[model samples]
Target: MEAALSRLEARVLVYVMEHVPAAVGGRAVEIALDPDGPPAVFASAPLAPSPGAAVVFTLGRSGRRVVATLTDADPVIVGALLARVERAAPAGDPVRILPLAEPALVDAGRAGVALLPPSAGRWFPDLPDAIRFDAALVQVSMAVFLSPQELADAQAHGPAALLGAFGRGERDLIRFGARPR
Candidate 1:
């Protein structure tokens, strides 16, 4: 809640949205799935589905599912972002929380940062060796909204670009089992 975010957190959220909307994506929409209804469909558009920003839609589940995309989505940032989103969020759209680094990583593909899915390998390898892994990587998807889109765009370039641009690393923790069953 805005009441919880520190001044800096609020400033950063506003600044990023105003300057670079990607930090929060253009829009954060929640989808209401109907079991017998047509499959939920998102635009098959570019990452920046909108003219100048990205759009992210999460499945509106029951529990308060916390999806932190950045290491900085720490308490302050989380409180601030949630407060801001609560403005438009409906009752069923689970309040995505900002969990600690480890849990965030573990929840990465499970709709943590994305409604689609993430490869399990992305989180498996070095995570068990938490210290070294955390020291090397800085998760920003949750913190800066556009960071995830940027990471996705980086694939066309190379891993070096991602590391250089974000000052972080995301090597495969292991080589297998990154998909859901």
Candidate 2:
């Protein structure tokens, strides 16, 4: 679909590309997420590509976990992203890369494992279940996270109408790395 990489996330993806093996290919850098924005450097080589369509990388739980996913794109990117993610991640923080052929099977509230085919997007073990969205909304929510009121308005207005509201809110949180106080 559209270019989903933020400025900081794109920098991390580029770092992963630089360190990953040639076999990983250019597509190995899909979507990258970091709660703290771009880091000074990324550490790691590369890993095997995923077997799904698109791939996702999310940083959450106060940077305690890094979640990566493969869906609707080159599997190589997923592998490469995971490798760099693990290296760059802090000690004890979990990193998972799952393969999702359909991006519709992911559940709310899980950690340390990547979901595969039929799963929609990656999972951040630290996030609450109340925030998770279904397949359709997950895609949109990635770009933004909706407020409770906004979500209710969308729900009442139409099912698909507010689909992107939650995603937008989510994106804001991920991009900025936390909720405003």
Candidate 3:
């Protein structure tokens, strides 16, 4: 696979590995950076087992980038990380680092995001509410790249749902694989 991650990206990956479970895969980490006020947004994809494969989604001020990593043949560790990744993402709209792994179906047409099964649905749901929920708390394995808007979004979602959606997105990416540019 190609090496697209920077030093910061790699650090974030390591953090996730250390904290999250192995089953989780396709982890996405989003960060928001703002000079004043709360962050704009923070989000991540779901996590799933990739065994030797891992897809990292990095969000920055400019836009979004993705890096794919293939670890040594160790499915168990991969699975563990995947789980932890799911637990670590943030939710709601706030200035913070939101790690989203699995990406529900992205409707370019509509600014909507949702969490669906592996390949059950075509369109995923958008962020439902803008309130942070305690029950929706998830752990943040690590963070590499972030932007202002992303941080604000995290504050909005809180933490619980952020992690959950991240885990789901990670799994979906692994299953669907990356698309050609």
Estimated TM-score for each candidate: 0.22, 0.24, 0.25
lDDT (tens digit, per residue) of candidate 3 on 63-104: 222112223323233333333333333332222343343232
Backbone collision tally, model 3: 80
Rank order by TM-score, top first? 3, 2, 1
lDDT of each: 0.27, 0.31, 0.31
What would you estimate as the lDDT of candidate 1? 0.27
Tell me the lDDT of model 3 at 93.
Answer: 27
Question: In model 3, which runs have C-alpha deviations exceeding 4 angstroms?
Answer: 23-111, 114-181
Give per-residue CA lDDT, model 1, range 76-158, as digits (tens): 32333332332223233221222222333334421112111121223212211111122232112222232344445544453
- Model 2: per-residue Cα lDDT over 105-172, one tens digit each: 12211112222211122332222222222321111112122334433554456424333433343322
Output the better candidate (1/3) by lDDT.
3
Candidate 1: lDDT of 160?
Answer: 42
In model 3, the Cα lDDT at residue 167 comes to: 55
